[model samples]
Target: MSEQMIEIQTKLYLYDLANLAKEHGFKADDNWEFSMANNAERISIQKNYFPTNVTKIVPEILLQVLNSVRTALKQSLAVKDAPDAQSIIADELNYLVAFNPKRPRT
Candidate 1:
């Protein structure tokens, strides 16, 4: 039996959408459409095309990911005030500091 194909959609913020376009080398006239709602823009992805084709550059993408992490951590810490979360965040920060991609390799 032949498998059926399904379509799906997802959304991203303008900043992230720009990065995605840049990473994919999409031209200015590329076929894309967007809509604005709740003070954010949204796009309809036809399928799971992004994950198969895109890879995240650390410098370009890490800041956004870290911002989200810190925001969530802030909210969680406010609600729970857990020492473990504080320690985990500290350790992660230190690890990021120690991770120098430009350092000479032995």
Candidate 2:
């Protein structure tokens, strides 16, 4: 179920499709019906296939995650400020510095 065989079959079908289309005096564009059909069928065949109940514990720091996202949304809505990654880091740094006990206000 690791998709090694599926990947090979996919390659075979690709070549088959190409050859068939060529025989009909037309080549397939990526945006062509054949392409779209293949793409659509792939979603049905392969998309939902996953392994069994391998219970992997994902440690989510939920409070931190939620607070970060909430703050980002608040800033975006209040000031139309879409937070970039660097700006978010800077904001976190600024927060730490402002609240730090060691840093005396001069």
Native-to-model Cα distance after best TM-score fit, residue 57 in candidate 2, in Å: 33
How well does model 2 score by local distance difference test? Answer: 0.28
After superposition, the stretches of candidate 2 with alpha carbons farther than 4 Å from their true spots are 27-31, 34-106
Error of 1 at 51 (Å): 7.0
Q: Candidate 1's residue-wise lDDT over 1-106, tens digit each?
A: 1111100111123344456557766665543322111111111122212411121222323233333433432322132332243454443321111111222233
Quote the positional error of residue 11 for candidate 2 in Å: 0.6
Q: State how far residue 15 of model 2 sits from its true place (Å).
A: 1.0
TM-score, every prediction: 0.24, 0.27
The lDDT values for all models are 0.28, 0.28
TM-score between model 1 and native: 0.24
lDDT of 2 by residue, 23-89 (tens): 5444233211110112243343223321101111111221233233334323222324434445544
